[model samples]
Target chain A: MSTGPYNYSYIFKYIIIGDMGVGKSCLLHQFTEKKFMADCPHTIGVEFGTRIIEVSGQKIKLQIWDTAGQERFRAVTRSYYRGAAGALMVYDITRRSTYNHLSSWLTDTRNLTNPSTVIFLIGNKCDLEGQRDVTYEEASKFAEENGLLFVEASAKTGDNVEEAFLETAKKIYQSIQDGRLDLNAAESGVQHKPSQPGRNNLSNDQQANKDNCAC
Target chain B: MACLWSNSNEVLIQIPLTEEIDNVTFYQISVKVGEIKWNVKHRYSEFYNLHNQLITDHGVSKDILPSKKVIGNKSEPFIENRRKALEKYVQKIFIFLRQTMPKIFVDFLDFHLYDIYFLLQDLSLLCFTKGDLILSSSRVYSFKPIELYAINEFLKSPAPNFTNSSKQLDLGPILDLCSQLDAFIIHGCYNDYLKSNIILNKLPIDLSPFKIQKGLYLSNVSLDMVTSLGNARETVTTLEVVFSNVKRISDILQCDILHKNTLEESQKWKVLETLDLSNNNLMDIDESINLAKNLKHLILDNNYISTVSDLTQLPNLENLSIENNLITVCNDLHRKIGNIKTLNLSLNNIVTGKGFYKLYSLETLNLSSNKITNIEELECLGRLPCLEYLVLNGNNVSSSIDYRVKVLEFFGERAADIYLDNEKPSEAELDKVSILSALRIVKEGKTPDLSMNGSS
Candidate 1:
């Protein structure tokens, strides 16, 4: 375990949201654990995961929360929208109903999260190419109109999952560098830590736990 | 006769020092012989010399006035009256402008007096009333020709007070304007300082507690501030009350108290079939089960509920989700009341197969992310005749495809469509005698053949 109280220079809180069965948990699991969870259960209320990744030689720990995608769960998941540094709004490529509900989900995200919170739109389950319902062009257009970052990834194949998390972190780090995201604000969701020895091991244990429950 | 005429005209020649020189040059005036003399240098030749110098300096070649052409034939009396009325209107505008202009600009205005003549020509076409003038001066701080028609129309109406018109006025026009602008009609008082006076509460009866039309939002409101809903309760069906910190259901249930003496009181509570109380601080399910009689969809996802006992009383409940609770045993779900179509027990502490035997009418069962290892535990769900979709995504069911198929085939013909991984059953697994028998049972709506199927 890392002896230092804080292992990373910054902590960024992320939220994964989308329609039901859209692979929100799968995307989070793939990025944090670097493998697919075949029997990963559907999310209930909100699931927690953390991973330490280095960006520009600065250790950054991402504390991600994956929420239930059902419409009814929106009432409880809406509270998690506040204070998010990065939001991963996902939809299944195979499901049209999930794609259709993006606007309402976007409205909730925009209303609840702070202005500086970066929202990224993800189209999950791209591995199931046969069951595709929503086209990429339409989803991209929707993302463009709403000023959100977008990508299509497969959690089963572990494709572009790392890029989604890394891109969000990079965007947030850019905001911090440009002074758009204030590090001192209590709800900015970014924390700066001093460098210390053996702190990387503590993050490893956290990562191991995340890998064990990467669904 | 010249002396008498000069003595009378002296009273009419009242020009300031600045205008006197321009008057002498432009009109070629002769001095009054009987007027009192002063030491001021007053020379007629000097005035002509100044005029000649000004003409040279301004590059004016011709010493002639511009022609004043009539717009139409002036022989008719109507045309003559129209021209005369137009001239008088122009003169009145000049008088008003002269009265309002700064003292320093009086000389400038006098030098360029012809410009005011054209401005008055345009002003003659517009109609003005007292209300129009007041509204224009109040709103447009600066004078402009753009608002003339709007101000004229506003003035022609009997009631001109736009802000206070809602009290004595019909809401038809206001609603039309809101619709045209695509703006929401907020009825109650907003607590924010910036938005304090933006929305008015002038209706005879308060519509605060009333559910606004669909896709409308009403937040941060208490139940007591509302009086009556009129017909809004029956019209607007979908209601969303989020982030209002509404911990108790009593705030919305106050409608029951208000209609205590009414005959059709219970119908009010039954109107709301979809209740969303997900993020509240509810420890038990008693309040929701008692109040929500006609509720078909109940979402208790993130509450601290430990058991499924509170849900057995709901007669019409179809979709029930107690996802993130302290439930461990599947037996707790066996006592469910209605034929629950979907049961979400995804993130619970259930480790054994004892609890899966209880839910009989379940179509979709989520037992993913639990601590269950073997496929034998799910065989208990073979009794569920309606069970079709099963999600075992995060469980430790056997790794081989055949083992997964063997476990799924335990449900016989009514075998629930198992969602284990990215894998579906192969032809060999589907062709197994026990699996075939189970499919026959599913088609016939009979119990699975336990004798032919080997025990786990």
Candidate 2:
């Protein structure tokens, strides 16, 4: 989202999914392009964006996929849930129905991704306090009971948008450091580039030879 | 620079009023694009067909538009609600499709006369009127830059500011301009290709009755005879004879009401370059293709041609597209289309690359979506010296982990310049290819190139 990810150590795939018209695309556009899309139409299928963010001194590229059409096109969005390292499940704070639909969205996220996937709950439209329908207390409690990381943010005012994305990346990077995520697993949704330039000559050759011999 | 704002699409729908014609009630919906506004007196069924065409063609959701009513459709409340729904539908579709507005959507709004597509119709019509001044024997045919550049920029000089530019063309007469300009093309115009620079923007009907010299593009509409004794028949360059339901090429030309001498013993389309015969029922390439002795490009997509036959006679044919056919064999295809540079055999039933070695001039080859299953079946492609772009996308071998690297190995180190599936080799892919190359050298009982380091 912040640009110049042509050089990065690892790529973490993220999917920002929520009900239709819940400002999911606005949140992503605010994070990536650093602008408020004033009269943006909700995306049809899937819109993709990327940003290079430094996590624990490592340049980790976050490839985010923002999607639309929940019930109208669930079949297309379901395929994106897989191979996602982080899932930012969003809901509009002004609309209680969007908040109440969080359980079904969380269920799809949990059932599709691996157990190590970091899911963060986001209560969007926090700037609209007078129109807020679902209180922050109940949403935080719902996140606690469901064992999910949660935040109350505003895509319109760009509040806590960075925290919601970076905190999830930090947790995913923490899992890699703790060795909970097997790097060799293809479905891990984390690609760690080995011997990234100017560091290894002998080791990279040995690694390629080892892979070739196995093949 | 004086004021700043976002460039957003603003859609306004005036309150629709009910008008009755004979006994049927209709909605006169008026919508505005930018500063230009127009009214459409369309029935709900007509709106349904237009919006449905846009959705089906452009992949927009069909649920945005309002549904028809079985009861109380003419009631004031129902009319008001449907008007709001249509407004929202137009707003949403305009936001999503403003950049690449589909033809159906533009036609629905009658914006074609104001948008860039209108330039093509205007330019063609203007050129035809100018061509009337010179005789058919005149060799000089060129337009002054002022004639083309200044008039073409009629929309831009005032710049119908897509946001607020108020320049407008009369919306009513331009509605039927397609059929009217099509009449000009069919109004016995010779060198039709040269007059319009060979690009006609989607003519809707058949032009079989008249003399079309350079290009004859007919689609979906059937024809009794493509018989024309035009003076420019000897110099006709492009001919697209698709979906006319003719089995033999002679069926297109063997009948003529005006001139029997044009077909009598032989009809030589001497310099014909392009012949498109798509969505027809031609079972095989006809021997009548020898008629276009200098033909360069032939498109036979969506036909029932089961074999690669009768094409060897068109010696100058360089490009051949036989996609979506029942061609199950290409064992001797190189003998037929050997000199062709680019070949599209996608969506066919062919299973092997046998006899492809003789296709030494081949450059770009699309064998995707076919029955090619394994690597050994395509081993003969490595022998071609000029194979640069190879597309094997829907084949079974593509699912393998190192499928890209294995395919690039066909070109050895020259794989660096080769493109597979329209993608340039990534750094990781090139790394894998180098390892495969080293392994191949080792398997041949020779010492591997140890001098080649990983960084290199």
Candidate 3:
């Protein structure tokens, strides 16, 4: 039944992680709901939001998990880090303290998620040029030193938000096309779906659904 | 590098056991590099070939590999001894020629298992074919994680000046120079950047142009009875219409496109599967949501609803999340959304577990951040046969002493089955549960089970 003309071909599990009030849920709202939540509640626990996206001509369903960013919720949020194909680590550009916690967040991400999980570093609230605390060049340098994709996006303005999520998918999709990430691996964080009818070969990242039901 | 699970790029070659096939012993090399783990088996002859090549081709003269015992080499003791020595040999090559890791040795460990090897080979050939005019930043390498690990290797490498390793694929010098570098960067570094570039100088990619946009995401607009589910595409299967007005699910069905001849007789819900209506102000669990009988997953989180009422019409509701609702009681929840496998009621005002009386198919229940204060509230959960994962974080009883043990005690022999607060009962907790079960038996004056040491 997934062979519908426009059904997505892959589901990539993504986890959005960062410090408290760094706009983790806001970024998810801006990406999926396409609007800013000025009164977004501080997340009580993990929240689920998904948006289907396209990368390299392939339809990919992004099952994004937005977790509570408070330190007290670390135990609950830590469980969400596993099996993530992409991790968006957000930090407030206006708060130097939030930027200082990057190393701690990076350690958790590198430890919990698999090795191939793409980590995208985002400097949220870039629209607040007046209260800017973290410089773009320093964060860019940090991203270059560490192996992470970097972007300065404002969830309120919706600037570079789509690109951060999509570029991570593009790299993940390319990994699939090139065979770096094996779908058979449990920790690969990707599920293959039967492509729509007449979409071409079953090779490359395209494989029949595990149930193998052609309908 | 401070990660607890995967050691950073430390190659661990564990030869725990060996296999014998057709009188030839194969030593299994269980290899683990950081988070990547794989297995490669090799016979003694293959080891000898790798050892010979390491010395002859790569100039590795330190041949400390166990001496070849052609006679009785297949014996038990000999295979055992060779297993240990072969492990040492592989580890030595990994540590010795780590900087200029020869291709023969890299192949021995299967480090080049991915398409990255082939792509790097293509880049190496290109750099060799062309002169060193272009910068390494001009071309991009596929692997990003390896690029970071390669930094430490590139810096520690005694001779970082590896120029145009045209020996085909550059798997050795590339991976050895901390693999997956901008070939131009490495070569260009050899000529220019190496002397002048700072330590943190890695290629930066501008990802703005890669704005990912494939499917339709509802733009900034409030949903109405007309524009909410009404305007959904004919082929759309998933609908995420949130931050909307108009109470009752029946209103969403008022869209002309959704209702075929009439609202109740609509087959348009056939193609629709998952619907997310979070952040809505609703007072009722209108039965029309079940009009789409095939709807399996429904998320109604962050609503102003008070009860788990009116969801019985959904025949295939497998997964449901009503996380942030105003439901203070759950006495008849199973009667409403009963056979669903996964349920999330975290951050609610549920006081008792009796509502979960007969959810036989419930496997994962997340009731974290709720207001259940009493330890007896969990006793009601012992009836559900399939309740395996029960999360209770932020609840009052979770902070009580022996909270995990008291909860595990209720499961009795199935204590190991239940996962309290998203974590399974540890070995000590399971032992305590067993002891508690035995104590209860003794107090009741019943005969002790044969598994215990108590005399009947």
Candidate 2 lDDT over B1-456, as tens digits, reads 000011234555453666778766666656554543556566677778977887777788888789878888778777778877776777678777765555566666644443343443344554455444433334223322222222334424443333222223333232222222211212111222221221222222223322344655555433442224333346558766666676865554443324433433347777678878788887887666666766779888998888877465555667889999998887655445534668999999878876465564577889998887787777678655557888999987778778888888766555666789999788788888778877788889898543221111
The order by descending lDDT is 3, 2, 1
Sort candidate 1 into its docking category: incorrect
Estimate, for each residue in B1-52, the C-alpha lDDT of model 3 and write its tens digit.
Answer: 1110123257676887799888778888876655445577888889888888
Docking model 3 quality class:
incorrect
Candidate 3 lDDT: 0.66
Q: Write the residue-wise lDDT of candidate 1 on A1-215 in tens digits.
A: 11222345677888899888888888887877777888878665566666777776666878787877876556546655655799999999998998999998898888767889999999998989999999999999999999999999999998888888989998998787767888778567676643355444344332342342233
Query: Candidate 1 at residue B82, lDDT?
Result: 36
Tens digits of lDDT, candidate 2, A9-54: 6778898888998889998988876677889786654666667788
Give the deviation of candidate 1 from the true structure as CA RMSD: 27.8
Worst 10 residues of 2 chain B by lDDT: B182-191
Report the Cα lDDT for residue B114, model 2: 33
Give model 3's TM-score versus the native structure: 0.36
**lDDT of the candidates, in the order given:** 0.54, 0.65, 0.66
lDDT of 2: 0.65
